[model samples]
Target: MASAPQQSLPLFYNDLQPLSSQQHADFKIRSADKAPFLAKQHAVPVTVEEFPLVQRFMPIVFSQGEEPVPLALMGLNEGINTFFDEDGSLNEPNFYVPAYIRRYPYLLARLRPDSDELSLCFDPTTDTVGAFEEGEALFVNGEPSETTKNILQFNEQFEQAGARTGQFMKELKELDLLIDGEVTIQPDGAAQPFVYRGFMMIDENKLNELRGDQLRKIVQNGMLPLIYAHLFSLGLMRDIFGRQLRQGKMPEPQLVQPTA
Candidate 1:
């Protein structure tokens, strides 16, 4: 069967051109400075492979609505990312950058709906990636260079990680573990707590209710720790809100959900 319609292109990719010798034989990708591309993004898609590392720094939450994919929350509100400075440079000296951000400009995508194959494509809009005299060559003498080879390998790994992430989400959905995630934080001296909603998270009550066999399967699949990591990472939502407050990017008051 034809694969599900492609997920919306990740943030920043405007157009995709299959990497080819015929079209881009001399196209070179210049290494740019820091990631200004991520400055406006508050969240980015993440995969299971990097969850362990990413959960250490950012809250790994699922997207709201059907077909929930894992995401690393960079900020509590939209249009604000706590990870970057005003100039769009990373503020944290030693934070682990997600592979999604690292694999920018270049991505593996399906060019045709009926085909299962993923084509290696890049964004032509990025100034760092184009036909240029300087920097790394995508093709060397009509053959993919070592740089291109390495990127292919990385993107391949990313695709595999994406597959595993799909399975993880499938298992969570089958077991009915996902629930609407809500949190209320009382900013220092604020009269009312800021209620945040519209995100999905693993429900602890549902998780605790799993049967022995079901629990065993989840444990054997090694999803238990990842679930806990997600739970633990929710605490950082407060920290992210604080970061936005300190940076003067605090959002306006949101409608509060009634207290239980």
Candidate 2:
């Protein structure tokens, strides 16, 4: 089941500190080969811009809440990641990694609650960026280095994409196109199908029933393809469950009685 960040801090971040030359002039950011923080993170917030790429890799579902955010499911169950090994390394090298994961350790956040401005910030708890001798320099001669500029640019783009994602969600809600999501998978010789819930997805029935003008509006505005991408990705849920079973990460079968 997926939920939004419940703590004061966002997911995967312990604390956020503004990036500044005065405080971290000598800091360098080291490239990490493995993402230990993502080992147990089954669901990650994804932007609408990534729907096409995400659909090819994982099932895209919205979190269960009044303000549901789109999420990419790495595994059906909590603490299970089919794509990541126990050590946080990828199970396969060629798998498409989400932009949210790639944007880790750095993000643009508002320093004040009332401010419209956002500053580049990083997780100070991470070893990825610090006063390290080896790695890309964050600043050179009291000015931001090229590496820092690139990081800032990436985070900025992410923020823009995030805003677009929000608008997409707002439209979906306005049209009443979202519904509680459920999936049932039955392994060979199993007594009952494994029913998975606690997520939200597009109400395909509602989508199909929309007025022709409403349908045309979404298609013209590019929301239709994203919706189809999400629907198509649902089939990957079974594939993910199979991966978990093969990797020995599947939990003991919990059977549910069939409804009359």
TM-score of each: 0.92, 0.93
Whole-structure CA lDDT of model 1: 0.82
Per-residue CA lDDT of candidate 2, range 52-95, in tens? 99999899989877778999888888888889977889887768
> Which tens-of-lDDT digit does each residue in 151-259 have in candidate 1?
9999999999989989999999999999988888887688878888878899999999999999999999999988988899888888888888888988775622211
Q: Score candidate 1 by TM-score against the native.
A: 0.92
- Residue 225, model 1: Cα distance from true site in angstroms: 1.2
What's the CA RMSD of model 2 in angstroms?
5.2
Q: Pick by TM-score: which candidate is best?
A: 2
The residue-level lDDT of candidate 2 at 217 comes to 93
Model 1 Cα shift for residue 3 (angstroms): 19
In angstroms, the error of model 1 at 9 is: 3.1
